[model samples]
Structure formats: C-alpha cells, structure tokens
Target: MTSAKRVAIMVTCMVDQVMPEVGVAAVRLLRRAGYTVEFPAEQTCCGQPFFNSGFRAQAADLAKRSLDIFEPYDAVVLPGGSCAAMIRKEYPHLLERWPGGVARAEALAARTYELSEFLVHVAGWQPAPAAGAPRVTYHDSCHMNRLLGLGAESRALLSAAGCAIVEMHESDRCCGFGGVFSIRIPEVSNAMTQEKVRRADATGAEVLVSADPGCLMQMRGFAHQTGMRLAHLAVLLEELTR
Candidate 1:
C-alpha cells in the first residue's frame, strides 16, 4: 500500500446526477489501496461538455474553477475517464488559445490521473484475487487510452480479478456515448453504440468494462433499448471484497 500523499476524487456531471455509486466504488477502490482520499464538495462538471460543444470561454472558466478545486492535491483521481481525459487533454488545447490560463490548466493536468492509472501507476494498487470470476471483456475508452495513454492497465487488473479477458472485435471502437455528441448527432451516435453493443454481445462476455461513465451510460442505454445485458467494470469491481 504505497498511499498517495493526498488523492482528490472528481466525480463528473453525469455520474453526480445519474450514477453516484460509480463514484463511491472509486473511493472504495482507492481507500482499500491505502490512499488518503478527499472529495471537494465544490467539484462539478469538468467543463468537457462545454469544451466539446465548442464553447471555449465557458469551458475555460470551468477549467479554471476545476484547477482551483483540485490543484492543491498530490493527485486528482478522476473516476470518470472522460472527465480525467478532458482535464488532461482538452485543457492544454484550451490553454493554447487562452494563454492567460495555460499555466493553471497545465498545472492541473500535471497532477490529474484517471482512477486506474492512479491506482496502478501512482498508488501501486492491484485487484484482489478473483480466481473464479466470470468472463469479462474490456472496452477501452478513446479518451483514456488514446488521450491519456493508460495502456493496458485496466485489462491487467481485471485479469487479476479472476475474469477471463475476452477481447471483442474492434474493442477500441467508440461506443457513441459522446455526451452531447449523442444528442447532437443522435443517429450516428446511436448507430455506433449499437455496433459496439453488438460486438460485445458477440464475444459472449458476461460483463463489459470501461473507465468512462459517458460510454457506460450509452452502452447501458443501448442495452436497454436493444434488450442486451452486460455489467459495467465498476459494477464487477465493486462486487469484490465486500
């Protein structure tokens, strides 16, 4: 248990409103790994929605606010991979145009980390043994993998949890749950999500895991809309060592 000096939890907007349990599971995961954890009550949406929507000023303001909220910690542990990716990836670009705020946003990015990244890279935590775990497949979120470069850490952790890692076809494809992208481009988003759901189903995996809540929400919706069933990675991880 190489605990982080201080770890802050950043619960993204959708999770705050729809699925807070995912946030709780993240806290449990961190605390169990011996990280001193704190959740800033002032935290809100990571401004990604606005940023992605091309609202630069509003997104920069929200980014500034997030920097203020999280800058003091040794590491910012973002439960939602999309939010973590936004603070790290998009902020730099936002700062590129808004030079006045680059330092703060860049500093925030310097310390920010997705949950599994912090767990494995910073905190040095691993999943508890799960020798009899069910067949599980992972969906690598675009932001977490491509943007944050988390590599294969989450997949390894899931394997440690005693689950069979069934690699789905085009496992890296976007699930079309691009937050506002889904609403803005409903047909495209819906179609993409449907394809992802179909692929995951094709693997015959009992669960599909991803670090992004937006992806999870879209996948869950597609499951409900299309009558497909798959458990989230968080749901599976939370079920362990209780």
Candidate 2:
C-alpha cells in the first residue's frame, strides 16, 4: 500500500499533449486537498487507442509498462475519465494472458480513480462556493458515465463549487469522441457533436464542462458555432477553490 497522503497523477496523452492546463489544475486541486502529488515522468498512454483499434499486443505492452510505472503509488488519479476507465476496467482483460498479469492489473485498478472521484470519495473535499459562479452545463463522457458509473460525482462537485447547474437534455449522451471513432467516422461524429453542442447551447449555460478531455476537444472543435465556453471539470474546480 502506498502512503495515504501521496498520490500519483496520470495526466494521460490528451492532457499532456493538448490540454495540459487540465493536468496542472488537477495537481492544484489535489494539493489543495492536502495530498503530495507525484507525476511519474515515464507515464504515457494507457493503450485505449490501441485496444480500441484491435491492436491487442501493442495495448498489452503499454498496459504492462503502465502497470510497472504506477504500481508503487498508494493511489492513482487521472483528470480524464476515459483513461481512468481504461486502467480500471480494461487493464485486467488486456493483461490476462501474461503470467500473473491479471492479478497485477487488478491490484492497480483498485487503487486508481478519476479526479473528481478521488476528490469527492477519497478526500471528502468540499469547496467554498464561488462568488458569482457562472451558470454551466456538464457533459458526461461515455467511458466515465457508462463504463465507470460516475455520473453524479462531478455534478455534485460542481454544485459544491457554487456553479448553477443547468441540466442539458440527455446530459449523458456521448459527445462522439470515441478517440479513433471520431477519425474513423467524421461525418457521424461531427453530427453527434453538433447535436450535443446544440443541446448545451439550448440550456443557455455560459460554460460547457466535462471531466473527459476527449469530449472537451471534440466539442471544442464545434464550439465556435455557439457562444458557450468549454472547460474541464478540474480546471473549473481549481479556479473555484482558489
């Protein structure tokens, strides 16, 4: 078991390469919750892309590498729910063929959590309500909602932060950024994203918040059509807490 006061941050590929501010915000939030956060520099993709694309061997290789990198932490937290889901739900299956791999994967999965989950469930954090908090709508990324059953944690956190929650129609609908799925079916993906943005726009929310970077990026591509601002939940919470 790792130290209760120490946790590892797996800032996943999208956050590292695209929206690093989310990772930075995540670190701030954890520290604010009184944990000494560690970033294992060797950490990389959790192999969701490979695993999704039917590259089992490559996915397995990366999973083993991730397992090695994160095994020592008392708890692992990620800003993106998709990557967290990859580790928590898929790692054991990916490593099942390797000797004792499944057991190792299970051990790691038990300690891993998505950002809001760690904060709300583990840290028991409650933010001082923001002054003049903006009205916001939340998007529930598929892996986070369906796969991990974490639909309410983020919403609860947002409420605690003093943001007025404006529920969008079908808040749990996929933003259609299924990683490679978007590239493989741009027309369908774009259509889905457009619908999602339209719903958020209809809510008249000033900001569209999501815990998943993939959904943020995908929706952001279409954000220009509407006045709604895009933000990751971590960034929003960090700003509110400060």
- Which candidate gets the maximum lDDT versus the true structure? 2
lDDT of 1 at 10: 90
* Poorly placed runs, candidate 1 (over 4 Å): 1-4, 96-100, 225-229
Q: Model 2 over residues 1-242: C-alpha lDDT tens digits?
A: 44468999999999999999999999999999999999999998999999998999999999999999999888999998999999999999889899999999999999999999999999988888999888999998999999899969999999999999999999999997888989999999999999999999999999999999999999999999999999999999999989
TM-score of each model, paired residue for residue:
0.93, 0.98
Clashing pairs in 2: none
lDDT of each: 0.80, 0.94
Q: Which consecutive 10 residues in model 1 have the weakest lDDT in total?
A: 225-234
- Candidate 1 lDDT tens digits, 1-242: 22346688897877789889888888888788777789999988888888888898898888878888887877788877788889888887786776567777777888888887887788777787765688877898888888888748888778777788899998888899887899999999989998998888888877778878888888887776443346545556767645
